[model samples]
Target chain A: MSLREACECISDGDVLAIGGLTIHRKPMSMLHELIRLGRRGLSLLVFGGGPDVDLLIASGMVGSLDAAYVGFEILGFAPNFRSAVERGEIKFTEHTEYSIMAGLQANLLNAEFIPSRLLLGTDVLKSLGYKTFKSPLTGEALVAYPRITPDVALLHVQRCDEYGNAKVDGVLAIDLLLAKSSRRVILTSEKIVSAGEVAGSPFEVNLPSTFVDMVVESPLGAHPTSCYPYYTYDLWHMISYLEYCRRGMVNDYLRKYVAGVESFESYLDLVGEDALSRIMI
Target chain B: MAPWTTDELMIVCMAREVENGDIMAQGLTTPMAIIAYYLAKATHAPEASIMQLAGNIMVYFDEPPQASILYNEYRAMEHAVHIFGQNEVYETIFKRADSIVEFFRPGQIDKFGNTNNSTVKAGRTVRLPGGFGIPDASPLYKKTLIYCPRHERRVFVERVDHVGGLGLNLGGATSGGREIRIISELGVFRVDGRSGGMRLMSLHPGVDVEDVLSNTGFELSIPENIPETPPPTSVDLRLIREKIDPLNIRRLEFLSGDDRLEALQKILDEELRIWRSSNVNRPKAQQML
Candidate 1:
């Protein structure tokens, strides 16, 4: 399916999970397409996020966020996420990384909640209303992490087959879980290979075809953030992006890189061949 | 012997925390901890398995990759022995909770050893980049060693505005039996399992109890004879400077203000230069996979 078709599957006010760890392998190009299509009111479910979450929030697309972390690693706080939460513009619920994982695990297991030994004696637990239970056998303390099932999950991968078996080259940080747990899975791959090719190496397929609802062949789909083994994250581009966000010019950024561009190819042209080459591994 | 800076001392102290056969884990934006893990892996703790990003996506590496902001998941691919997903890694860490040694750097910490990385609130102000894995996993590790580059009053607080991770006694069974240590530029402080407050374990050379007392926001329990923190051996210094971290990536945490940015830029430029000069072929788009 086309990127547009994939975006069509994502409706407004849906619980969307953006896959990848912080600052790596985000489905940015598909997001750009969604922005171009003027998507709105998304409730983001993320474990570790970076520019993808910030950009969505900055673009006024995010209505609420349930996240573990949402900041640029060393560059500092995510400008839009911070402001939105601070001003109460967006509904924000914080979960530690493990809790988010536990939530997903609960969802996967068809359980109401999973018992976790984390978040005890912390303000996060205090603010979240002190939900705890004692283990029946061991009588140990545990926090009840409820299921967090997303309506749709968007992911970027190094490669995928026409049949939708995807290969993620680097860390599979929650991408597989997002694919399995979400009600719908959309993947944007750098290349679309033959099913035979995927069959040649079944062990490498991170997401099976049964789980993927849609697959779009979008090369350099994780630009700005990295699609490992292909390119590193564009640091200079991110710095400029941070500058734009810090200066309260998110609309300008969206217009220039996302809305203003005719297509993802044009976006690439703007990013330029040399800059892309420099980041390519 | 060349004189060692505070950052180097902190790195050495941090490396010492890693037991010989322990499995140590660290999360994002931790060059100091990363370097220490590498140093430990290369030196005293040869059998220690260093899991980057806690167990997110990357695994044990034989050599330290060049520390570039660009070199995260990308470089992890160069040598990762086994590339497991986050779920597998988390389960492994949990299963080995009784033996794993994890390192953390909280934004703010209190005398009770309660740490906060989620936010630092001042009046209505709240910080972002919420605790990634700190609150969730730190309490479960057998040894949770925290490294704070700056030992200022602001960092060592009376009480963290939020308890991103539980303190010595507050964690109950999960965190109670675990050993917690704070390695700072001044010295090493340990959470006294009995008192539930921080006590001076050792002082870095040239730093006295007065300096630590003045810098800390709360009172500390001091021993009768506080030993000086052991300085880095010549071999350790050589490994850090000449081999593992020639780019001086470990200094990022120690620097502040404009200096940190400038230092980062320098490191980036050098990493780019080295990459450009290297004989490896850049993978074309189609061949990347």
Candidate 2:
């Protein structure tokens, strides 16, 4: 599939699950592409959350979000998420930071739901309308989080073949689970190679060809971000976003950078070579 | 020190001290105490105000802090408040509090009252709950209080695993000469200005000096004629159960790894026990609980 086909696969109201946390190995260019195409009311479910979710929420495209943690770590908080919640613009169904991951795990296992001990004592689960039931034999109260099966699983991979058999060298578990659980999988890769390149290392092939629905050869695909092994994270942009969030100019940020850009390439132009080069540094 | 029961005795001690208009902060295991402290302020210290990190104002006779209640009243309408992020409502209050009181489990708190809400060793073992901006908040307050239910030697140790937060530097430029107070079920202690060592302040009623000595890991200076903490009253207990418990405002009570079901059940059981024991004969406590 071409880049345009992969971009068009996302429709309205679809739960778009993205890979990576913060700036690490996220499909940012594709995300910007989806935003440029004006994808609205997409409920995003980010596992091990970060800026990808923040950018979506900030763009006013996200209707609902399910994740464990959704803030910029150490640098400060997620200002866009915070401001949105503060303004009552966004509606959130918060789960304990871990339960969000557990829900995805249950989806991979093909289970109906997963029981979690993370939401007890806090009002997070109850606020989400998750019921608590006591096990008859053990007398332990159980919090049942329904399986998270996304409409589409979008990820950026280090390498992939024409058929979409992909390999990600770092952090394989959650992305692999997402690939297995979602109905459709869209991959954006730094390089497109033959199956021969990936066949020698069965252990390193993160996503099998059968599971992939489409593949887009997106070199610098995780540009303005990082796909790990292939590139280091674009921290300068991340730090700039953090500073922008601190100033509470995130809405303006979305309008100018996220919404204003015509395409992912244009978005890359907005980031420019100097900023992108920092990731390499 | 043994866990202090939410009986009449502890309530009275907390009530007399917590005055109106005073910003009170507390840590884990003392959610009830923090609640009781606020209740006493409301009834006795009528001018006292209560602000919670969860974004609720503790009105005198209302339910405990529930996110749903807060969501409906303030969060829902405001729609802009980020509950868990830095620079949220909690950070605003944390910056403004005159007296900031926090509870510390030894494993999580460092020498300067810096807390570690992370896994013990970085990148090695279990990931503990991520730390809030406690380190930034700890050192900024006029007064910092550390409360503990367990008065073990390990808890009262010389240093903590990591400084999740940095308290007012006792001897540093930030100190501004403000001293930190450590309160436990066994006794209350303060950092000695000269040595930075823990020194005895007062003990809870019926607590022994030897027990305090035995449990503390570091050497402490004993003050002569240590005062006993007054017990909670019937009225104080009434306000706590009825008003505070129902809100469910307590954060950090259960360990991150504890079964959610069991932890919640234990909370329910404790609430029931408090109600059954204190409210039958005394109807007012029932109204409050």
Candidate 3:
């Protein structure tokens, strides 16, 4: 299936999850396309936060966010998410920084919930409506975070074939687990090589085509973004978005990037080659 | 122009050293040094070397300046130099500087140079503007200079509520030898070469030794006769009022509650305005020159 068709499958109020943290090989083009298509009311579930989340939230398409550590580094704080929360515009399920990954790990393992030691003597867990369970032996109370299984998992990869056999060079476990756990998986790739290229090296395939429901040929897809080994990140944009979010300008951001674009082509045009050059692997 | 404020005086003292190619780092009260460093380059120290936490030699402009001058490059320039953490620069470069400048409120500092920008004694917790790589960088620098306005016992305590960065221990271990200075509105001080505690080097005019001793929690080592810190010179006052004061950067004091948020927003707005206006017409260079 085409990437757009896979994105089109997403209906309003669906739970969406994307892979990667803060510009390291995120499926950014696919995210931009998803926003350009005007998919709204999304409950975004992710372990860590970055520009992709910022863009989605700023577009006003994200109804709720559940994550940890969402901000641009030195540039500033996460203004969009902060503004949305401040204005009571979006519902949020804030979690301790560790629980986010643990929840995803729990889902990948098919556990009902994951136990965490984070938020002890802190109000974060209780305030987020998570329940605490006491250990049967030690009597130490542990916070249980429910497993998060998104309706769709969008991922960007370094290499893949039309058949959807994907290969990621580094950090395969998280993306692989996310693809396996999600209801549907979408793969955006830097290059669509022949299946024969990776036929002999099956272990190199991060996510086999069988797991990928859709595959999009998006060279430099992580443009104006980072995919480590491939290119350095566009730190300026990340910092700017973070500053904007810190200032509570999520709506303004959405108007400019997501909801503002008339079409996918326009969005692509706005991104320009500068962003594209960064991911030109 | 507005009259020269003491904050500018503090900047002039620090800037003179930075202008001489001395590596400098500062803790939370870095605004004065930040403006001073930049202004010094424009006016006096054109050839001075400056870098940020990431080892990149760029200046950054944020609501609260993050690390060294390099972070400012992100705000001043249009293109981004994609890096991981914001404090990465300070962690790498500022930690190993030849000199550092730290500023604190009266009640926040302890004797060992641990600065508590967070909470006072009570259950009341005041979250600081996040740690800016000081914990790692403090101990490694060759020299550390602390700045404060009010000289009271609460300010010059024997120990701080929290150590923002490492203190005299860093100075003691300096392979090339380190110097630590404490500059305030009232006077200047240096750690006693023998005792490792702060000793009165000089006092500002109108400031008496009793006032200094009374406010300090620890006993101050006094020389026979301490000289007075020179009054702000005409050039110093001119630079402070005309060049730095016009920006009114000091109003960005990090307070708690809504005021903190508002001050942050204003700083951000000001930085963004400066960034946008400066680069609006500048053509993108083929390479970083």
Candidate 4:
């Protein structure tokens, strides 16, 4: 299916849960589509933070972003996120990676909330609006994170078949949980194989066809970000992108590439052939 | 007479804490702890291993991995086992894992060693990056050690405003804090038995006992026989300066020394990228079904 068609499932008020580690396999193609479509007031839940979050916030798409660490590693601060938080443009709340994991885990566990000891005594509970109750059996304090079943989950996978059986190559890095927990799962794949090829693998299929609502073949989808087995993260692009952010011209970048380009293919073209070829591992 | 840079001194003190066969984990932000984690493995604790964030690269360094740690580009990516898509991280590395060492350099740390990397002011809410790990699986780890470069009153506060990480007050198994060790540029501190709070274990060179006392917001325990921090032996200094860290990216740990060091790292990293892509046959990430 086309990315534009896939984006139809997402509405303006939909809460999105993005899958990726820092600079890793994020659903950039669909996120760009969402931004391009000018979807507003998105409440987001993400595990690890990266350029994708920065892009979303800079585009004024995020109403409230719930995440753990949102800064670019070694590339300095997340200028758009920090400035927006300071300007009161986005309501920012912090979650430790584990607590966010617990929030997602609750959905798959078929429970009201996931009980964990991690957030207790930490302001993460109070700030993120978690509840704590005494365990009647042991009389021990337990922190309960409300099950956050996102309106939609956008995931980028290494490969998937026509039947929607998907495989993610690298650190499951909470990608599996993100896939399973959300209400609707949208997958963008670098390669689309036959169901025979998908079913032919010996490894566990982390994201099954049952959970997937849409599969869009978007090659080089996680540009400037690493898609394990496909390419390494584009350090040059990331560095240049941060320089633009530092200048407070994230919008300028969006205009030139993200907003300016007619589509994902055009954006990749603007990224240029040399830049794309260089990052491949 | 030879002297050690504060970075060298802190690294040495931190290295002493790692015992043999201890599994260690430190992210990109904690460069000081990263060096110590590598130094211990290279010098004394050969049996020990380390885990990078996202489980991307698990490697031992005979020398400081300047590009690998700083730019997140090891160039040796193929040799590194990619653990992505494997549900083993949360299952084995975090929750069900055995004893491991968690290293952090928190933005705001209180007297009890509780850490806050969430917000600077409770009202303005200047959001720092949230706490990364340990909060997820704090109990499963054997030891939680802190390494902060700055030793100021604001950092060592009466109490942290937001407890993103646990300390003497909240890290215990009962969902309360257990004893934690803190290694900083100024000195070493451990949870004291008397008050269940942090106390000065030893003072580093050029850092007086009064300097620590004055900087700390809470009263610190003056142990009966407080010893001066053990300076890095000449041999270890040679290894760290000459052998281990060729690029000297470790200097970026200090504020005054950071800008230039980081610039050099970026340049070296760019150059390495060019060289690596041209010469090496970079391995693709294994696609495990």
lDDT of 1 by residue, B1-289 (tens): 6899898899889988888988877787888887888888888888888677546544566665555565766565655777767778778877888767777888899987788987777777686688777877777776778989989998999989888877776654354466678999999988856766899999999997899999999989999999989889999898889887888888888786578778877877788888889887645434755
Report the number of the highest-lDDT candidate.
1
Give the alpha-carbon lDDT of every model.
0.82, 0.57, 0.58, 0.74
- Model 1: lDDT of residue A3: 89
Best by DockQ: 1
Query: What does candidate 2's lDDT look like per residue over A1-281, in tens digits?
Result: 66666778799899888875444467877887787787899888774456787788777788887654455432334667765655567775554434555566686677988774434433234455776777666877777777878999988887888888876643332567677778899998888888877677787565788888888887777754555444455545676776677677887777777777666777678889866644431
Q: Which docking band does candidate 4 fall into?
A: medium
Compute the lDDT of residue B277 as modeled in candidate 1: 91
User: Native-contact recovery for every candidate?
Assistant: 0.77, 0.00, 0.00, 0.54
Against the native complex, each candidate's DockQ, computed on alpha carbons, is: 0.66, 0.02, 0.05, 0.49
Q: What is candidate 4's fraction of native contacts? A: 0.54
* lDDT at residue A162 of model 1 (Cα atoms): 92
lDDT of 1 by residue, A165-226 (tens): 98876767888988888899998998999898777788878678898988899988898888
Task: Tell me which of candidates 1 and 4 scores higher on lDDT.
Answer: 1
User: Chain A TM-score of each model, in the order shown?
Assistant: 0.96, 0.89, 0.84, 0.96
Give the poorly placed runs of model 1, Cα more than 4 Å off: A138-141, B57-65, B281-289
Instruction: Indicate the DockQ of the complex predicted as candidate 3.
Output: 0.05
lDDT of 3 by residue, B94-137 (tens): 34455433332333555545544322443443323222333334
Interface RMSD of each: 2.3, 22.1, 11.3, 4.0
